[model samples]
Target: MQQACTGDRFFTFYLLDGFALHGFSAAVEALRLANDVAGRPVYDWLAVTADGQPAVSSCGMRIAADRSLAEERDRLLRVAPPRCIVVCGGRMAPPPDRALEAWLRLCGRNRLALGSFASGLYPLARAGLTDGRRCAVHWEHFPDFSERFFTAKARQTAFEIDGSLYTCAGGNAPFDLFLRLIEADLGTDTVNRICEIALRERLRETGERQRLPLQARLGTDNAFLIRVIEQMEANLSEPLRLTALSPASGLSRRQMERLFRREMGRTPARYYLDLRLERAHLLLLTASQPIIEIAMACGFSTASHFSRTYRERYGCTPQQTRLAETARRRAGGRGNAPEMEHERHVA
Candidate 1:
């Protein structure tokens, strides 16, 4: 990590198409408040886009950029560079942008800190910037991120700070990440005041899991049942048999069956099948992995079996889902995948 600098820390926000506005806002707001709380500009930031024009947000809002990638690169050459460069992304990962990838690599060569949110991490991963680095990926996108970037140590945590790289899961997770960064820069006293001003209840540390526990998500506090679900999630690629799961849950096979049916309103086998199908559905919509490969990854023996099961669960085949998503992207509903508004940075 670079030595922490005092005075002002300048940041550049590289906004990608279909970027999540909330994540970007959360980060900037933290720094904005830091300045207010400190009675000076402790932190400063600017927005940048590929064309130096306004960038559109995921929710259809537009934010004007302060400069273009080329302009920023020129500034990096002629002037002091930003303290950090952040990539902001939305729900879907856009297509690769060659120009953006080069810019990010340049940042790395310059030893500048790099940051990203949600699918924005894709660009960093593709540019080889996140290789062997710890990254925090939103749980909804964790499967695709990990599958595509095996070298990056992807975690389902709120955020991760590994060396010069910073990553945050999408949504409100950015608030926690930015707060930590602020705390690092200004100290605990200032952070506490900032939180009070923002009406934030507490500070969340690193290594916090991104998702709710299965027990909470399912509206049940049964420890044994939750343990079995965790096991199921961990072994999705090669499902465990009821006999194996029964021992782990401390219930006989028959007892497990009764418990699942009563609490979940489904047989244990049925519940397990649904879990696999749910994972398969998300991958089908968001990933480019071949149907057969997805089926195998989800533990189906054959593509035919996988397609049949998928159709029953989703009311459409995997191919159909892929086609629809393609059409949607082409129609500009999704602004096409992975575009950085022509500069092609991560996200």
Candidate 2:
């Protein structure tokens, strides 16, 4: 890591087509505000693209790059390289071009720190940069990312910093990340001033959770029920028997069943089964794992049983769901697989 200095640090943002506009604005705006308040250039940034042409954002805004990938690559060989390079991507970002992927590999070889925002992590992961690293990805993309990159550790946090690699779940998360970076490079006073100028009420720490708690989302105050559901979520790969949950919840089997029936309108066993099946469904759509492996991961004793339960709930076989997802990706449309919409949390 480079020592924090009073001199300006250069940053390069690689914007991909369909990149989130808010994420780009938040990052650059923070640095812009920091320089404004300091009355000097504490940070410098350049926007770049693969071919040096304008990139279109998800919201249909066009952004012109300051340079092309080739130009930046040549410049890196001649001058002091950027302190950091961040890839900003959109929801439907396509797989990176081979030229861009090779350029990222060159950056890695030069020991330049790299980072990503939103679905930009997808390209980094595809380029093998995120392997064995903890990355924060939007909840909407977690399933697909996990399925595609089994070796990478994905977290549902606001942002993550592993070594020189930084990533965030997108939206205003880039603001939090950039603020933290500004604080580390300058000081808390500068960060606070920038936040005030930006009209932010509070600066969210990187450790703050990105997802709302399930209890709050469900609008329930039943602590016991919440605990039971948490346990079930934690034990999805190896479901607990109803009798075993008694000790964990400090409630008898009958009591737990009654609570589940009253609160969720389902038996405890049925609810647990549904949880596992739902997990399996997500794995089917998001990951390329085999049906049998997904079945085992979901704690089903056999693939037949998993398929039977899946068919009953979703009215389609797991293979059919995977195929549909594959077709959707090929067609450039949102996948046909059903998502647990309520489970999603904004970045």
Candidate 3:
């Protein structure tokens, strides 16, 4: 159904528990600037929580709700409901919300432009709204999201839009998505002005990578070394042999070994092991996949070997990492998880 004689395009943002304040604020500010530049309210929005109370962000900030999910569902029956209903999410994977899922199903049938970003996309994907649609989630949560939502064609890009559904990976990625919305409704000129007002350098186009380039990350301009690392990331699950990786760099094993030690401060084998362990660490904290599965996914042939090696490097078993994260979340995601720094230090 078409919007009922709506002068301004309206949006209803249903902010989930522990939603990312950065992305949510970016979206609101983008619309506010669009109205400022256009000399009128080209867009209108309302922020709501699950139960009509203020939402707590991942960083522990409280955002007041304009309405509740129940209220928003009732409003959908009235004339000119929001042109889009965006779900804001945070670092935590959302638990099952039957009400939200059912409401999302209704949104899909209503032909409303549904939107979500970060871990928030879980509900849309879980609700079956993203079936056969392209979607993106934050890189930190990508492993879990991809494993869980096979029906949704998941991408590691900044954002994805298939017909009326728009999904973004978390952080500043959603800023680009919201700017594209403004450009669609207003024009390129309006979007440019909005970016200027927001002090944004430029709008990141869709399909751009959610992660920094390998060159930037490694802080090295050695093309051969970078190529080797690229292959390592691409083949994390099965893992490429050092002999095979040497061919990627056109170097003898000894030459490549020196390169790894010089640049990364670790032997090639140690570096490869660390890379795989880093991925496992992330999966352990953010996902609930079984230990054996996680071990295999990270190229560990056995869970015992994975556990022993994990303990040697991180000073705890994989089980401990997951348990600590669960404890932190139960504590309402307040302070950082003790093992979080270990993962962050991964090169």
Candidate 4:
């Protein structure tokens, strides 16, 4: 153990019930490693919960808290507050606690820096701290988060740092976020040492991709096929005819169809139809647009046609899908039900 640095920073991690273990561990471990390598306590931290008791993680592991939100609130005017406060979020977090929301608002009024790990953005957004700010959440939660909180800009990147707000897509991404903070506070040399000790090959910068690329995901290097898919994705509202795509792809219509069959295991037209349907499905779940407007946005000739095709593909009508999503939300399930059909057309 090393002595404390003159300018030691204090961090408080508020563990919501069922918090993500990987994100919490990654963040705390990064700070711990920084202290070990610096030969001084450059950072100090304490785990906190809503009540003065241990909180269970999503994986069923438990972490004891040093204090409760009530205790901290009572001492708010007496002791200096931590420099940063982080909320550890998970899939199974219970309904938003009003007490927690109030505390977050108090933190915001004090102008203290705040952060969220994984799905913690939900609570932060509910507390109105993330309004109009870009934040990162796990990709699985992106659609639901966007639908619920229209004011916050939900990005799909690995992490985001907008002034006093910090957010990271949960998992190992927090390690990268903590490294960035360490670099800013201590320097690149200390960050490098921490990364080396943690066996991290490289530090992913903010705004870098969190998900795999299309080519890597599909295990193919077909440039023409990739370009055609890109075109389909870009022209969702105005689908291009095969003839129009042929000239752009440098392949004749027949050649493109044959290539789509070989690479995607489906004909070009069928693949394109599935692509549009997937976009429509996402819009139905995440946007409040009317069904007819969604149909037009997805290039459907009419709302009935869109609903018919959606039923055939998803085993439910578009209205039904929307209803199911609403029911799931009302029931407190934060994620969409698994798609009945595997999305083979996703680029």
Model 2 stretches with alpha carbons more than 4 Å out: 1-7, 90-98, 126-128, 131-133, 140-154, 277-347
**lDDT of each residue in 49-128, candidate 1, tens digit only:** 89888887776567777788888888788878888999998777767989899999999999999999988998899999
Model 3 ranges with Cα > 4 A deviation = 1-7, 336-347
Give me the candidate number with maximum TM-score. 3
Estimated TM-score per prediction? 0.90, 0.76, 0.90, 0.73
Residues 207-271, candidate 4: write the lDDT tens digits. 88888887896688899998888898778778999889998999999999899999999998899
Candidate 2 worst ten-residue window by lDDT:
338-347
**After superposition, candidate 1 runs with Cα above 4 Å error:** 1-7, 326-347
Clashing pairs in 1: 94-337, 94-338, 95-337, 95-338, 100-343, 100-344, 100-345, 120-347, 123-346
Q: Who wins the lDDT comparison?
A: 1
lDDT of each: 0.84, 0.80, 0.83, 0.80
* The 10-residue segment with the lowest total lDDT in model 4: 338-347
Query: What are the per-residue Cα lDDT tens digits for candidate 2 across 110-154?
Result: 899999988888878888889999899887567568767889889
User: What shift in Å separates residue 292 of candidate 1 from its native position after superposition?
Assistant: 2.8
> Which lDDT value does model 1 have at 12?
85
Winner of 1 and 2 under TM-score: 1
What are the root-mean-square deviations of the candidates from the true structure over C-alphas?
Answer: 5.2, 7.0, 6.3, 8.3
Question: lDDT, candidate 3, residue 221?
Answer: 91
